[model samples]
Target: MATPRLFVKGTVLGYKRTRTIQRPSSTLLQLEGVNVKEDTGFYLGKRVCYVYKVGRESRCIWGRITRAHGNSGVVRARFQHNLPPQSFGATVRVHLFPSSI
Candidate 1:
């Protein structure tokens, strides 16, 4: 039997660095119930998706968790394209795939 995949819900907390930095930064995401640095490692390399609607059409930007950020259980994800400002405070999905199984 095939194993079921799990999708963890995360919130887009904005970019990786402070506003004054002025350089490009990876998107920051905080997973639900993940509030510690230790828990972030398990999610490294996991796939992330930001789904939104553009008029009648739905679109999604895919990314992967590249590394853990800070001690607050936040993660840094690099997407194929930079996410828009509207993505902040929005929800994203983290999928458990590319499994070791």
Candidate 2:
């Protein structure tokens, strides 16, 4: 059987950017059904994964939610490696493991 779904899907809106610069070290994500900042509290420190394909190989970059980005539910994440620019608009998997519950 296929692995059961146990994670939330998030969107890779883009990297954190300033007026004239972009910081790839951090990325901004909006989780499904999360519309308010308070809803993001539970996801903080949660694991995030960006999966992609290169040639015939599938690769994944792991990261963790660092903090809430704004009044909305977007959260900031720091990854082991900076995500590619192409990741913009891509889908990310937010694992609910390592739970504090």
Pick by lDDT: which candidate is best?
Answer: 2
Candidate achieving the largest TM-score: 2
| Residue 97 displacement in candidate 2 (angstroms) | 0.6
Question: What lDDT score belongs to each candidate, Candidate 1 first?
Answer: 0.89, 0.95
Superposed on all Cα atoms, the candidates' RMSDs to the truth, in angstroms, are 2.3, 2.2
State the lDDT of candidate 1 residue by residue for 1-101, as single tens digits: 98675898999988877667732359989999899999998899999999999899999999999999899999999998998888999999999877664
| lDDT, candidate 1, at 95 | 93
**Weakest ten-residue segment in model 1 by summed lDDT:** 16-25
lDDT of 2 by residue, 1-101 (tens): 89866899999999999999999999999999999999999999999999999999999999999999999899999999999999999999999887897
Candidate 2, poorest ten consecutive residues by summed lDDT = 1-10
On the 0 to 100 scale, the lDDT of residue 70 in model 2 is: 91
Runs of candidate 2 exceeding 4 Å displacement: 1-5
Question: How many clashes (backbone N, Cα, C below 3 Å) per candidate?
Answer: 0, 0
